[model samples]
Target: MSSTTHNHTDASCIFCKIIAGSIPSMKLFETDKVYAFLDIGPIAPKHCLVIPKWHGAKITDIPDDYLMEIAPALKRIAIASGEENYNLLANAGTIAHQVVMHLHWHFIPKPDEKQGLGVGWPATKPEKKELQRIYDELKQKL
Candidate 1:
């Protein structure tokens, strides 16, 4: 990261501290735009986090140029994990289970059912008319 970009960090943010070297991390990989490190409380083997060097509270807060570097970083992390199947996940807000406010992508290796990210899908079906109404609203908003 450029010196000016490195300065674009929040002192109160743990992730910012990690990127700044104030807090230690099990370092994995890093580039000028992003950094990947092992999760202190990993859900599975090789589980880690990929964060933009520039701090952002959420995905929408990141610029397009910085966002461009995220996918390749995730790919490198996955490849190094040596797992054929894995999950790339990011939680956006506190209500969505984002414990950390900083924007980050989780690279979880799913070696087995017991490992990696686990969740239960509770699906619901609404009336077709309701679905149509929602879709129309979204289409117009898009």
Candidate 2:
């Protein structure tokens, strides 16, 4: 982890306050490993956040156990939201516009075509040579 990343600011952190029960939330479900709560500022009607119990500034900073807990919690939220589809988003860093320092997953449920999370995909595709270069570069890091 980088030194610039503030691991957590418990007393001032909104997520920490939520986990501490100091902040009220529309509780959906929870486990020893995770907590699922309705998004106070929801993009969709059933938009919610699935967060690990342990505090971490970013996804890369979270422990393996906490990371592992996300999948099942996401599944539960999807079913509870009564949606067959969902959009999972995790904003990582300052450039990505991660307003909250705590690591969390946005599970935006979309039951209907019009009333759900709207996603925008880039139209451009990288050239084959560029793709190969990227693949090689990533593999080298591994």
* Winning model by TM-score: 1
Per residue, candidate 2 scores C-alpha lDDT tens digits across 16-117 of 777767788887877666788999998778899988777777877777977898998988778776877779888888798688988889998776778667
What would the per-residue lDDT of candidate 1 be over residues 1-142, giving only the tens digit for each residue? 5523556788899988888788999988777888889998989988899998888888889887778999999998877778998999999999999998989999999889999889878999999999999999999999
TM values, all candidates: 0.90, 0.84
Error of 1 at 68 (Å): 1.5
Worst 10 residues of 2 by lDDT: 1-10
Candidate 2: what lDDT?
0.79
lDDT of candidate 2 at residue 61, scale 0 to 100: 78
**For model 2, what is the alpha-carbon lDDT of residue 28?**
83
